[model samples]
Target: MAVNIQKGLAAAGLAPLHVWNRTASKAEPVQAEGAIVEPSLESLASKCSLIFAMTFDDAALESAFSAISALSNKSKETENKILVTCSTVAPSLVQQLEHKTKSVSVLSAPVFGRPDAAAAKMLVAVLAGGSETEKNLVAKYLEYTTRKITRLGGPAHTANVLKLTGNFCILSVIEMLAQAQTLAEKNGVPREAVVDVVSALMPGPIVTGYSERIARDEFDVGFTVDGGLKDVGLMRDLASSSSVSLPFADIAHGHLERQKAENKDLDWASLAKIVRKDSHL
Candidate 1:
């Protein structure tokens, strides 16, 4: 993730690409690759006209913005500065960030891709914010980072909403794969064989890519088990708040929780392995 941000910054030709990480040493690799390391988030936020953040969740985002808020008044008072947040957070929380940094324009710009996709600059970005001038500034900056940009709605966390909804679709596929592969393995069919059949039928990136991992129990933490659980929890909360019932989401959330209970170190794909082992497959 740090590498992707560095690559994007280099590609965008941004000067003094300052970065701050939770751990000091973690930013070393990016620093070695020509990114300037900021000692604190406040320093980073104060110097830039545009600040782009990609943290883990709402709490982290809020913490970063809180630091930014502490320094907001020290900078120029105009709305010339912009914050392009690329984290997958709750819409309501994003609204809070915007309200806190009232002088800074906030743009919700969440990305979709694995680490490799991000490094290759092939990630799809979803942008949602008002201020056409701000959007253009952001788009110009991101042209070197992503293959495409999708603009949704203004003054709303539309990008985060879309990103979460997109994850639900992936979660559905994961649940189906877990159940179907478990059935196949129990029936004495080779997991690889089952994967091949599904791959041929689906012929899409998600199916083809995850099928091999499920066959080989390759649930490494590019996306971790804990993270999947977090998303499922958030999705369920969103559904409940909107008065919608999501049964499949309920099942997926259960699988994630089960994996977390034991072998909590496994990746998101560990949910499939849980079903496989449970079914004696």
Candidate 2:
């Protein structure tokens, strides 16, 4: 994802990109692509006016923010710095970060796309920030990274809420596809035939791509089961906090847990396998 973001930026003529990753060697390739690899998070934060972070979870985000906060304090240039967090963390955590940090302008811009979509620069970015200026500032750079940027025009964390909800919807679609495909196969219908019917009806990349993968039993980890579980868990927590019920989330969560219990390293679309197993197909 980081590599694609950098590549997109470079393609858009945004040069001298600076990047840092926990695994330094992983960033070496990005450096070879003209991005300057920073030795540490603090160095990256200090050097870049606009910094984007795409960490795995809240802990990683907090760690990155800590380094950015330190840089803000040390440099006394908080007003000039903008921190754009692209990680799909809980909205509450983003709210907490905004509340805790008064220096740099923090924006939530979680993206929607697979790595391939990102590589193609077709990612959709959901953006929210403290102000229009802040949002616009980040949007300038994001324009290069994503195909579309939708501004929520509210607090920074609102973008996180939208992102989580959007993820839940995607998971719901995956579950539906899983169950539907399983039903088709069990009823003496070919999986490809089912996919062909759905492809005509759905006519989108996600449906077509995932359906093909599920039909071919090609669960090559576009998104891991663990990652899907994490997002579903986040959705469940958020839903609970808001007194909303998500039965499908629970079902997806259960499927992921079962898959994890079996110690299977599988893609998220492998949720179809749960239904396939249940149907004895």
Q: In every candidate, how many clashes are there? A: 0, 0
Model 1 lDDT, full chain set = 0.79
- For model 1, how does the per-residue alpha-carbon lDDT over 94-169 read when each residue is reduced to its tens digit? 8776766567677888888876776677878888885887788777766655888888756747788788898888
Which 10-residue window of candidate 2 scores lowest in summed lDDT? 73-82
Off by over 4 Å in 1: 1-5, 8-13, 77-79
Best by lDDT: 2
Residue 5 lDDT (model 1): 60
